[model samples]
Target: MTKKVCLILAVVLMSQASRACDDNKEEELAIQQSDEYFARAYGFTPETWNTLYHKPSSSLQDALDVSPYEGRTLFKRPQSSNNSFKKYFNRDQEDHENHGRFAFAGLGANIVNTGLFNNRYTPANTWRPLITLAKRIPISVNPNFNNPLGSFDPCNSNGGESGICTSGSVCSLFGGRPSGPCDQGQVCCINVINSCGSIVTLNNTYWQTPPTALRSPCTLTVRMDPKFIEQKNNPICQIRLDFVSFTTSQPTAGTCTDTFQVGGVSNEVPTICGDNRGQHMYLHVPLSSNNPTDVQLLFNFASGTTISRSWNIKIAMLPCGATYLAPIDCLQYFTSTRGRVSSFNWQDVAGARQLNNQNYNICFRTELISSQKATRMCMSVCSATDGDAFSITTPPAVLLVASANTGFASAVTTDAMEAAQNSAVGATYTDQSRANGITVATCLYDYLLIPGGRDANNVEADRYCGNKLNPSPGSVKFQNVCTNLFQQRVFISGTDTNVQVCTPIRPFKLTYQTDGQETAVDAVPATNTIQALADVSNTGFCLEFQEN
Candidate 1:
């Protein structure tokens, strides 16, 4: 190749650029992102092709000794990439994302016969034959542009659906329509076989509750095909399941009548039953595994079921070290800084009863990456106190506030006790703790662990468990409705009536804990919270959270 042809070849290679976006995420992961990442590789730039032609080495050197500097071979590096392709792929993952890396020699003298850039456009062809000597292949790799498997590789997003990133000719071969543009003259394909049993290999897929009632044991297994280890370069590190619309039979006491289990993961996801709509969970993928493990979403309905089930769950796959990845130990993760978190099956999910034996952390994002800053979080019972919306008291469904005398760690059932029985305070009293401010420790069986929680007086009341938001003679029912002017109101019949809003500045974290036993207690116990009721079936709390 002559010097003039080299200039023309460099222009052609530069012109080969595809449309790309600067942002990796536009909104929630459900929204199909048009992010096209392009990375300029450091290998075989035009100046590095000088001395490799005359002397093809008996053993390959780190990089082609084209010149001392100016340009360097990409396969090896002056920046210490060693000889392993694994480090190169990890360092520049965006290069092999929706867009594959650009590998070319621009113009080379006798480089074709030396067997590196044999063809004008397919330089990686010669590199393919050399990898077979290894006993085991890498988990993921850069799909050579000329490889036939690239034709069916279901990668990238297209028109709000998971798409196979492939060339136009190859897309047509599989009867897939070219929905959108991908990098490197390829198209995002939208017509692949997607069903419950079929292994989903793409990102951003949707799995809804089966329309038919008979479709029990419905499983949608999301796993990267381990067979094509050479083509998949980006490993999905985390899988976020957005319960866009999830509903099923409520749990019986604490046990699930119908079950939705997450399987094939190394970690154990707690089996949950009942209404989980508007909720999300993060399932992590172990990166060190030679073959990427599968994460299965299984929904098994009880035989001869009566409740109508409907769900629309969106599966979003995130690459390793993605921004949206939740903490490794977190089972349920929320990216939105502000939202309401109702306990499983609260508010009519079994007649508004709290699921028993519950223990899990409800995590919220406090990062400054979003449009809103989660600097401080203010939580109150969901503004819905009309009926039994915010009723997770230890004693069945009622709270008794002493109009006269109330002390810390004392029974708060009052209103003459007869009037409390006549009123809708139920036939029993709830978990009572005049355990005010930071000394709030009367609650043990079921309570929200809010670190640095404070009362309206701005005192450190870091824990809350009794009847209302703070210590108040507020659970008194007036005209058959529990109304507390001293606390924040639910839409009951309601707004915060407190003179001052309590502590809202703490590390945003809350753990909802419910003990295994729900047996009724005749009197308040010195340990494990207080409960005085004929039936101790307490309703779970409904909390509303805000980030800004």
Candidate 2:
């Protein structure tokens, strides 16, 4: 052949060889892509694929590189004799069920290659073998299982139009509505009545004036209302008095022009007259048959130019048999009905008016209902009396002062009772001193509360007497017994027809115990009285007093 003919023949042979090589490469690429799809879809490694294909043992890398579908390609004609397709389908079903029922449905379509690209064998569209992979396989087994909006059905569970009830909106559970806004330790009732855990207040008001007579005294009466008596089923209940206002023109001692007396008929004796102008008065008076009346304010203004006097009173009723856990201060009951009275002037016998600085005189009485003992009594005189002209002329009463070794009935004179008398006279009386007096009286009088008489042969009489007359240091019962002297004089003055001397008493603090295991210190009004009752069974309930 010539050079030109040889060049043309070489180009044609090279072109034919190149075409054959390209077709072989395309076929290999197709086989690789098909192997990869089956490995992933059927959850098999190269080793497992070899075993399923009945191929000889080989290295992992060699088996992966050599496609199982190279000789038996996916594009080849189907064979009924080879049941390997069924095995792949079975394995796919097992994997689908293991992961979840819906996880491998799309995987099944890819492996079977039934629909798209069943006849396509071109290498340009390699992804055509996995067309169903892009068709969207569900991430979860149940399509509606994880839809956030579809998970909760609030309307069905809560009797409402929406899943969550609106604020302040009513909701029903088990066919019942919720109720609230109840008080502490209380529950709201369906009947809509606020009857549980309530505190009730009962109050009444009255006004009175004293008469102008010398022997006959004026009176202000207080009794339980008919309605209250009917409800409580008793004549007497717990009560306190408020001396809202007391105004007297001339409250002087000698002139008897403006004298006043105050006490419970059965529980307390009448107090000596002192200047009570603008002075608040509080009295805890229990009205029983013995003291059938609550209180009496006797006035004797026989000499002053202005004999006018008037008073306003308010009474508070508490529940009967109610236990008071806190200390009750009777003096606090004295509301600011009027201002304080600082001074007054009394006309002398020579007709010359004398300026006398006025001071307060208050009295108090307490009865121990259970102990049946002599009442635990306390008295205080605020502004000192002008003792320069006043004197107790009556013979001193005799009292049995007992000692550990020998008990003697001696005459305890009010004349020598200078502590309370001088304290009141000098206007130097203090709340501390008054408290000391109460402590002594309660201790001493408690000893005198014998069953039969004031004799030494009584049971434990010596011990009781010794404890009262002689007390240890810093003890409540160690104070002087001057309160008894003051009480004697007040009693004498109240009953004495020849003299009408009124001693001045002031408000003082008192310590008392309540039923609830608490010790309370409160100021008791000089005009009021105190009463304590011992428990009958000698239980811890003993030593409780009624608060005014």
Candidate 3:
């Protein structure tokens, strides 16, 4: 029995020791699992853990535990690779050292640990292990505030007619009607106020309607609001009164009486009021009224009660000189010169073919129509025969005749013939005679026709001469003398002439015919048919005449 008892005791002692060993193994596994969880949550590696903890592990178990989840770490890693959690740990440790308190670390650790304990036995609580202490750090919150404009009530809903105040939140005036419980930051204005104890401003919509009309012997008064006036920087502002429309019974001027008064002082009224009905008439009146003052408009029909008058007026306050840039009464420049007329006649040989001599004479005389000034003139000639060219000349006999026509004492210089040249139907030639700078308007011109050339082909005669001459058949067609004579005149700057520029003020052309002892002006080669071509080449003259 003694032997059996000893053996039993030995067995019991061994069993107790084995059970103790098993408990130790389970506790070791729990600790290892907890470390793995932290490594996964905070991206801790054995290298990093050693660096942060400042100590090496007893075995490679802590380091080896980090290998199973090399790339599969769940938490975000710190930017630094050497020690991932060192900064966070150091921050917490600093707080504790500085304030003698655990700061966030103690609280976060307790919450995470408690959560882990509660969910430890259950695999269903996947989030428990993932819960991190760092997430417990406080986050700030911000909220938006309101603005002034949003606080006001909408205009239409507050008690006004619907269509008039359709969509705006701000109150406004419409055609002399008031409406709105205006939105914030906007003021309400009235349409028309007879007595303005304060300055009255008409909203934009009020101008849409036509102004009211007042008749003769009637008075209209308006008083400005003092508050509105004071807000303007200029204490002395001007009021612009527009007479939009006016009508009077009488058509004569000075028959109707209408007047305007500002601050009890009568002002000058518009003259010729009846003539400008329906036209815009603006009046500016200066106002120095610090208090509410009357703007009175009075009409007196005392002269004639039968003379009835009516006018539509619009009023606005503006800074001085606002409408001072009024319309100007401008004078027009004189387009033509005033002068007397002078004429002379010449009889010349007419032949179907070229004349026997190479040239024939045509003559004209000029007399001063006005005060003597340098003048520019041009002349053209036309004849039935083509190639009947003419040139101006100062042969002694022709010059003698011209000198007699001018009535000048000494023999006039033949300088007038300088501009003369053989005529071409579509070509322009200037009078070179005026080159010597003749200030006297009186002069004479002589042209010699050299008739050796052949006739110019009549191209589409009907279009040119207003006559159709049949080329064949017994076409006993009478020649229209009017078609034979084409004359043109050119005038350079009249009294104020610029010879260098040679500005042609008025240049015209005419056609004439001599038949049955009668001379009649004919319209041909129409006006502006010949234009002074500008010499862009800048060669001879500033301008030269050319046929278009």
Task: Give the best candidate by lDDT.
Answer: 1
Q: Per-residue lDDT of 407-433 in model 2, one digit per residue for the tens?
A: 333324333332212111110112232
Model 1 scores worst on lDDT over the 10 consecutive residues at 38-47
Q: What would the TM-score be for candidate 3 when compared with the true structure?
A: 0.23
Model 3 clash number:
8
Local accuracy of candidate 1 as per-residue lDDT tens digits, 1-548:
58866776564444323201211221222122212210011011111121111112222363344322111222111131222223223334444342333223211211111121122112333344332322232222222222323433335454455555665744553445778776456787764432345345555456665445447677776765322322244455667776767788876665676888888665456677777876677676765435557777888888767888877776766554233344555566554545677776666432436665666666654534264334566677665544344444332222333333232222333322332212121222333323431112234556666666655656444444444454222352333333342221111101113211234543356777766554544333565444433223446767776666
Model 1: CA > 4 A from native: 1-196, 211-213, 225-231, 266-268, 347-350, 369-375, 385-389, 396-442, 471-507, 521-539
> How do the candidates rank by TM-score, highest first?
1, 2, 3
TM-score (C-alpha) between model 1 and the true structure? 0.56
Tens digits of per-residue lDDT, candidate 3, 1-548, equal 88976775575455445444354354344234334432332233223212111233334454345431121122211133233223223344533353222234432342223221231122443454334643663221111001111111112222322111111211221123434433223323324433212122321111111234333345544433322211122221334454454544332211223332234322332323332232232232335534434555544443544644555454544332111211111000111222111111111222111111111111111112253321333322323232212211211111212223444432222223321121112112332333553222110111111122111232111000001111111111111112123222222211111111111222221111111101111323564332222111000001122211
What range of 10 consecutive residues in model 2 has the weakest lDDT sum? 535-544
Sort every candidate by lDDT, greatest first. Answer: 1, 2, 3
Each model's number of backbone clashes?
10, 20, 8
Pitting candidate 1 against candidate 2, the one with the higher lDDT is 1
Collision pairs in model 3: 198-225, 198-226, 199-225, 199-226, 359-449, 415-433, 416-433, 419-432
